[model samples]
Target: MAEAGWYPDPAGGEGYRYWDGDRWSAQTQLRPGGTSAAPGAGHDPSTPIVVKGSSDDDEDEPRAGLWSQVKGPVVIIAIVLVTIIALIWALMQLGVLGNRGPGPSNPTEFCPAVTDGNYSVDPHPRDGRVYGGELSYPQLGAPWSAPTVDGRVPFGRDVQTQTITIEQNYRPGQNWVASVLVGELIDGDGFQSPEAGMDMVARCIVGAFYGDSPVQREDVTRRPMVVDGREAFMLEMHLSFDVRGLQAKGETAIIIIVNTSGSKNSIYYASIPDNAQQYLPTARDLVNQLRVGG
Candidate 1:
């Protein structure tokens, strides 16, 4: 009470008590085995009871200790977040995730020539306008004209397919005939898993063939194949479709799917006439050469 000065210890301790101008703040010092003096007891005002350490220093120790306790978990959480970010960056660099720009960082590569005298081979990256990602596939030459859209394809609308036509003769005489179609649905949002991308493409092709048509998929088979050292899904089925009101029949049709990401994918497909079994070996060879990206 004496003008906020040190007084006799009120808590019955040997040390002295500090009284602020208004209240008795919990600030005290302990004496060596001496009991606390009663309030207003005798104490020298001229001889200040100096504490060896600063009060601020003493108070800060508890807070620092509390922070140290939480620091371990906080550091662990930060390390985990950094690891996740690094993994995602690595995947993007590998292009397992969708390419961020106009095309893959590296150009796509195609299979080498694996054709017999009767068959021709042409390897080139598909036109970028068709799909933005890198794509390289073999085209059975000459008799096979560049891929064309069958009927009026609405792309993302009614159906999705990249139609390739093969004929013994370019036109007029329809001697040997076959079709190689790469089918997939690519929305504006894109895909994350390569498998999912292939699935959508396969569904688009199946829907196009099965919708309002008498023919149904037959001899369906599923297997794993490799493309550019990456695993791909292969589906072998027999089916037919109406090309311009003319029903074209084929056997041993095949569909190969490679999942590049959730939004991007590649599908290698073909349907050849059963009578043209001689060309089957060549077609299969070409399909084996299919690669998604370099």
Candidate 2:
């Protein structure tokens, strides 16, 4: 029999287990590199001595260390953390999370404060000459009367169908009208180019004129062009709407924004209702004849 001390685990796990004279103890420790006989080999014991089997080459072989045991779990944890961080960054970019700053200011908000000396309130001429500031266009005869300040917004003067009347609660498309606005672009307009500014202004007009009404716009197109040798942009669209107490179902709208002298811009807006579709050709002719200067 062999007297026992610490020996290779009888269970074949990678360590040493404590052994008493009668049986193996529960205590354990790291295995030293080789397999050896039990301590005090010639003593008497109740149980047969057990020896672990190993080759001569295994004497110098390294055991699996702590890093090897935890490597897989560490790599898995790192991958999960990276995925979570990437997801958060994507959400922030899409404005689903994190702070998103305010959008562009509506250009029409600056119109009321514009006080240019070149602007005047005058009745437009009937003999093909209609003037608003430095801008002018030919008049559409009969039902399309002279331009007036009665239904004018701070942004411009307008000409309307003769059948329509201006009232205290007048909406823009309520009576189909063509407006010509000429003024200097103010500081807070929130746009640096005529194209971008005109697009914003067109959206504002839709909101103001057809408040709370379901409006569908179709055949919308825009292009850059030269008007009286000045840079200009034109946006045209067909608006169909269903509003309470309004007889017209839809209208064709055209908006032209021209960058004139210095910081000034000229705008021409026209809307012809579906009920009076016959006048659309006349409106087009008027736009074709626009003149920017003397």
Candidate 3:
């Protein structure tokens, strides 16, 4: 029959327990410094000590308090998990974990997507000399004119020699002619060796140049040889296509990556279309006759 107030614990603990008007509650508090009599034993009715849970106790409050106690740790654990995942991704990017061999992380590192502003068709030298006289090739006759140079520098490097290209003039989707590209051998970002660089450049050319057409590549050949007294890597393939607007059915393409002086490299690309299959020998001769200067 005690009024709702804090009283000495009936469980004989050194603390006060909350007693509702009807029953005892599980709530407890530190014992106050004072002599107190049990409730309903002539205790001062006006000086009743109130503790928490003396009023209508909410059952959900205990669960909510328990959640509050553990909420910080749960949030901390979630943050730690996110940090670990991000660190793993960074390591993978740095080639520390889940390494994928020596290749460019991005496909565009060597052969970027061709945009109108990234390339040009300029008049080349008529003397067959190109790249500031560092290279030379046989000049084609009449229909071929002088090979027009298409200068393309990768996205980052500002050097004009990053890629030096020259090709015989021909109407796209109508005729095909042989072309050559000389790329500087970059050391980092997956260009560790001549062979690796050759592979990346070859694949980039196929995707960037013929991606819009339904092209099929076959008869791929890769080898190591010496060109102009320097070590070189060569890649050759036949590409066949049946595009609606294109007149030629296929072409034989070649890529030659040669190491030059000062650790530089030259890339020679040649494509002779099926329509010009008779010129295949001429193309091979051109490859065989490549000359590279310092």
Candidate 4:
């Protein structure tokens, strides 16, 4: 054979052995710079030897290289997973993904001492058809005078002229009282517009108050106001009437005309005495709270 080939020792020892073409021989040597000697005598028995092709150092080098190659990707994947979990937890805590607590609210403060419980929903005692749900009136113990009825039957003369009347202290022998009158009347077939219907209501009211006395109409002012989210016409006028043979200065009358609750085109009339000026703001606020449907 060409020279004695280097081969692993056949005795399962850790060293290169000089092998003739067919077999391992006793001529052996250590790798790199170690001395060469007979196979059984070359190295001390306790000395470590490295096999030519299969060493612990060779296996450890490949494993360390593999870890270095994949280290960045593995760390990136772990960070992304942690961030997603944190975001989901934060959203759940903020109630964006679940039911949490109430946000905020507002309270009605019309009068200084008024609250929602101070008002009561009162339907008409006699006529069940007429409904004024939740009439926001002053409580019985309040400072202002409680409402009452005038001498006249609150309901008007015809089926077309049903009325609901409220007044402030019409005592046993009082000369005058502040009043509020809400009336529903039929719309005339010939009355083509709201202006015409308003004119007719004005004529009727003036006739009732004037009653053959020499009447003086002063400052007949008309303006637009809102009632229950609908547009209403407010007509304010001052008149002097004959009472018990003496010319008495009547309270300034403010009449608000709007569409009726039940009728398609009929008029709903609301009148307030200007003498109740102190209570006007409170009254307007209370009317704003009126909801039509029961």
- Candidate 1 achieves a global lDDT of 0.49
Tens-digit lDDT string for candidate 3 (197-257):
7656766666656646645555478799888787888878887776565567778888777
Rank all candidate structures by their TM-score, best first, as comma-separated numbers: 2, 3, 1, 4
The per-residue C-alpha lDDT of model 1 at residue 69 equals 100
- For each candidate, how many residue pairs have backbone atoms clashing (under 3 Å)? 13, 0, 0, 1
**C-alpha TM-score for every candidate:** 0.40, 0.51, 0.50, 0.38
- Measured by TM-score, the strongest candidate is 2
2 or 4, greater by TM-score: 2
Expressed as tens digits, the lDDT of each residue in 1-294 for candidate 4 is 535456666687876775545555644556522223334445433345566767787898899999999999999999999999999887765434543211111111211222332133334444232233212222222333344322231112111112222342343443344344333333444334434455445545555544454444453676765556554555666655444533234545555555434332223333344444564454444334433333
lDDT per residue, candidate 2, 1-294, as tens digits? 556567788898868865666786454468532334443354334444445645543543444465677899999999999999999877765435643211222233434432442244545455556655456776545555454443332344332212233221234554444333332333236345668687556766666566567666654677988888888888888888766656677788887777766666766666777776666776666667888753
Off by over 4 Å in 4: 1-175, 190-193, 245-247, 261-291
What's the CA RMSD of model 4 in angstroms? 22.1
Over 11-47, each residue of candidate 1 has an lDDT whose tens digit, in order, gives 7876776564565535465532233442334544334
How accurate locally, in lDDT, is each candidate? 0.49, 0.58, 0.58, 0.44
- Alpha-carbon RMSD to native, per candidate: 17.2, 10.8, 12.6, 22.1
Q: Lowest-lDDT window of 10 residues in candidate 1?
A: 102-111
Error (Å) of candidate 2 at residue 158 is 9.3
Clashes of 2: 0
